[model samples]
Target chain A: MANSASGESIIRRFITIISAFDDKHTSMSVAELGRRTGLPVTTTYRLVDELLLERLLERDPKGNIQLGTRMWELASRGSKTLGLREAALPFMEDVQSVVQHSTTLGVLDSDEVLYIERLGSTSTIVDITKIAGRLPVHATSSGMVLLAHSPSAYQDMILSRPLTKYTETTLTDPAALRRHLAEIRQRGFAAMPGVIVPESSGIAVPVYGSDSTVVAALSVVVPRDEENTAARVPVLMTAARGISRALGWRGKLKGTLRQSH
Target chain B: MANSASGESIIRRFITIISAFDDKHTSMSVAELGRRTGLPVTTTYRLVDELLLERLLERDPKGNIQLGTRMWELASRGSKTLGLREAALPFMEDVQSVVQHSTTLGVLDSDEVLYIERLGSTSTIVDITKIAGRLPVHATSSGMVLLAHSPSAYQDMILSRPLTKYTETTLTDPAALRRHLAEIRQRGFAAMPGVIVPESSGIAVPVYGSDSTVVAALSVVVPRDEENTAARVPVLMTAARGISRALGWRGKLKGTLRQSH
Candidate 1:
């Protein structure tokens, strides 16, 4: 029998306390964590102290707990994200230099677009995402690129669920979303105007890896009035292919690159 | 009374297990972790499983455990390192472009060099000091700058003990190292030839934070030809000051900057 009721697995409680701080909330006090994890204040304090001692969580100047540098070191020292990020950096720089707007990197994390990297001019566009922040899978252009190429099960999971809309153009209806995803797949990129934000149009292309799997998405946010959506698509696709090639994706991308052989 | 032994502090054990993998070893098996952490096999397995469940540790293709991206996400999302690295990035890129060697950003971590960011040509260097990896305080140029600018008590503590020697040029004599520190303080940069490696030289300059405290060391590793030593010193100092200013260091740095404000 699993000892779910017993306080034996402090690790689960530890996770519970941390998982409480999602995109909406990043910093929380001890009492807040206790209430969120439903643990006693004393136990939360003890475990939090332990985590602080281990440098897994840090206390800010205001005494709020935040994730620590040690945790980042442990996670990034040997992660798939680092390899992908490293391979993508040069090409992303190329895209950012050319696009001269906002170039962002997003990967699917639990049915949402978890942005790993984003580069932008300070006055370019009203960006909605932050590094390591998440957005809905059906509302953002990068999300649509990933969703269109995702497995059928994942597609059904999102399509069957109630989709939240950010703006009037956001594809909240499951039928409309399915049609939009089809168009995205057909065009090999997603260009959604005023979907996530009113003044921004998002253009995104999927990046493949050595395994020929869509590993990440490269996206740009431009002014909604910009008529060069098709022009930006090739630039993004080229950057994505460059990143893919850097990651050992030797196979030629469908319309993005010229055949060498 | 301490009811739980420090050994049972699974969090501490988890840190120890992960920290065991350094520049030398990036992956480890359960058995190796047990040996390194001095935990039993079953305990190692259980703890590793817990870490895996939390996505703090990842399994490589060979079944060895390595650090995960979730660690980087948690560590970087709200940490000062991200800001520091972000601010240092453009200048670091500038330095990497000019130096074309091992240009790294290292911070003071318990008197040793804990490299936070490294950018260089992959084939330019023979050394493997990595991000999050530590080097001896006296054996590295960046380590020397950090140790020199550190509290006098830390210097006493380090010098009161044995000084390690990696190469014949390594400063093992405490009195000599003390002299070297004084010189570094006077010159505003530390340049040592063949200290870490026989055929290499490391030029480092201190990077100050908003509080005007030296918080990091920016260094470049070059082939120890003595011909490029003078040429590299100004470049390293310039990059260091550029990063320092980006970090909000308002103080003037001598010898590193050619322009006078």
Candidate 2:
């Protein structure tokens, strides 16, 4: 809770340091870390020293600091993300084996779709989804499925924002997107062709929790020209249901499914 | 890095709060967190407030706090664990599909086998492996494979310690375990039947990184009575090589394999 002279808390500074590491930028020197985090040299070194001492960060053999295995362990040991990923993996594997493409399980996090687990070959399609990677809510089938099941207020809040148009098919208009969300809800799935990429299509279905609330989006990426919506949707829906069941979700009664604005 | 009156840094306290949650206790009230963490009530409340402010922890509708999605994202985005898991998952899926058992990817962390990714039917076997769960280095097939590939000094350090005897079949003797490690290295896999759990057996092979270093242990847990080491070891070795190649490992040249300890 202690605030630095610049009015930023130690936690915020810590977050800045941790956020500097991504898939491509996994390790760097303390000086580079300070520059990336915009923290003072002394402050960065001090914080890095603390984090290293706590085993939250580690120095590679090359002496560049990287996120430590301990940090991952601490975050994952009690994480709901890990729980959901574990429950969905077998079903995802089933889907991947059948579909022969990338299958991903994503959840709504910080207003974006954060992919938690993915399987299948990377060479199959132009799939950009990665574990812990985020994509725009409007440009992804997984995002649309999650948004379609979200509360009307949250949906409105998301749609009111300026949406990024990633491709020719990406719907950026709020009204158009709302209509798409309605269709997605009514159809019980979202199939977007070339919304994020030009050569691939994403089909996603809602995976529910014990309370019958949509907890994640189970999705698959396939070649855009080979977009077998009707065929792929069934496989996705089946796998989603299995994952939902694994999460303690009983099948919804015939009429209990709710619609959003 | 400042230590409190108790001589513990805030980072240590942060770890304590996160460590309080596990597979069973994913959420808890601040009061209960204080009790579990053994921190003073005021300190717990203060730290909890800070964590919640940063979205490192989240409050549920029932007022119970859980590890936030941000924590998972921050921990995962720059993690080598995620990178390793991603690389090994597809191959592990292939192994799991064929083996029809629990496939796990483990790495040496804190002198134990920390399972980072696992797949398969939990109902099929008495598998103690959970994502983010730890097992003693000597009691697990994955751990033994990792230990066998590690430097002799590190192996000596581990074998010199008092190891827990989890089952009657668990080899705790330094000299005997050393011989077994040698055999595992030569045989190219470890098939430990009833080493940790009497109802289950573990089969493991080493996964190599780009530099040809033993990066992880890929394993499967099956029923002890159905231990098919002859058929399973080859499958594991094949998949481990696939995972290693994905991690940028060039093919191992003939006669390059070295024994440790």
Candidate 3:
């Protein structure tokens, strides 16, 4: 490898350029990319050209560059996300078919609930989560399940950190959140009502892995006023267990996030 | 933009580094990455270090790095794949449930079909195609379906380029392949039996986009001996149409791979 500071610096800048394209900023002009990455405009354009040549980032007919199918190809293949999502899909679809609501699989990532997969009917609860997207662990049911089953170090990390409040009902108090997480462990699920949004309840349970570690969370978002959503619990648990079995996690399974666990 | 040769050169190396991660090589040591990227080992290591710091790549317990959740997050959020997959999922699932094999959604990229999604069942046809993987346009059913409905420019581009044969049955002759593509257009679907492997067959239908252009190909991999797999054509056609409708394509749709005059 080159020891040239310049070579290393360019790689850092390139990563920044790549990272600049997130959920809100999928396509960007060369100038915009330079600005976002804090690289010189000329450098940005040159890198953009190289990326385009390699098909890692593609320019549309309009000339705005977006994540190339090749970039997606390179990043996505042979990934834990791919393997986990494959095993989780059938069961997730089953839950979505029955519940007709937002059914999701999430894992603990940096103390937040990173949703690995989600499916819901059009008429069901409007969810703010996306696949490969993250939401606060203490503020969502899926988060709670992961948080509850996670090592104490993770909870301490989150509790010690600043908690952003999304709704009035979000448990910002560390003691309260700790108790709630404990309750979730005891109840085998987390029922978070009015935590992330008004009139919505997120119910999530642990998805175990081969080592019996809580590796993921399976959850559904329902209307806060709905009492019938409880019947969905057994179905979700069964589906979660099925995914665990597929992954060869047959221990006194705790929970497994479908991906990146 | 300044035309700094140094700037251009560095950016070029960066793309090379990212491109090195593929289905066949998901994780590699910095020395290995340097060898693949043709960059200096020190350069690869230093840049990879920065990327590691940014969470673009995470080190495994073995101290080797793999693509990180951040990469997946940035690639997935608000990307076309999200909308495209969301639109195609129900149909893809529908196809998989009945076919109980490898169901996939692929789009044309760089004169090849890049599979963005794949759902593989236990009894699925064994193939090397994985999610975020590519196959030659003339050798794959999905690629053929996409190419059959594509513009003349794409046709000419592929024709001018040498067609790499994957199997003995693959149509490598330009004239024969052109005719094969035309028939796929005529039939409105592509039945590529033994095109890739002897024991498997691929059936694909074109999936349309907002302007009614064939933007994708939805296909299934089934056992070669299963004549009943032909029944999957109607199911796939229906699913393709559903996805196309969702993508804003509409008409008294002819649900086939053919180009209408």
The superposed Cα distance between candidate 1 and the true structure at residue B193, in angstroms, equals 2.4
Docking quality level of the chain pair in candidate 1: acceptable
All candidates' TM-scores?
A: 0.84, 0.95, 0.88
TM-score of chain B of 3: 0.89
Query: lDDT tens digits, residues A1-261, model 2?
Result: 446778887877888999999999999999999999889999999999989988999999899999999999989989899889888877887898899989999999878999988887688778999889999999999999999999999898899998888889999999999999999989888989999999999988899998899999999999999935568887888788888888999887562244211
- DockQ class, candidate 2: high
The top-ranked prediction according to TM-score is 2
| TM-score (0 to 1) of chain B for each candidate | 0.86, 0.96, 0.89
Q: Which candidate order results from sorting by DockQ in descending order?
A: 2, 3, 1
Model 2 chain B: weakest 10-residue lDDT segment is B252-261
Residue B160 displacement in candidate 3 (angstroms): 3.8
For residues B12-87, write the lDDT of model 1, one tens digit per residue.
Answer: 6766777776545667888998898787788788888988887777787689987765665665675667677777
CA lDDT for candidate 1: 0.78
RMSD of 3: 4.4
Instruction: List model 3 lDDT by residue over B1-261, tens digit each.
Output: 223334445555545666777656767777888887677666678778877886777776568777777677666764677778888987888888888888899999887888888887645467767778788888899998998888888898988888877677888888888999888887788888888887888999988888778889999998888877667788888888899998898745443433222
| Candidate 3 local lDDT, residue A25 | 83
Indicate the worst ten consecutive residues by lDDT in candidate 2 chain A.
Answer: A252-261
Query: Which prediction has the highest lDDT against the true structure?
Result: 2
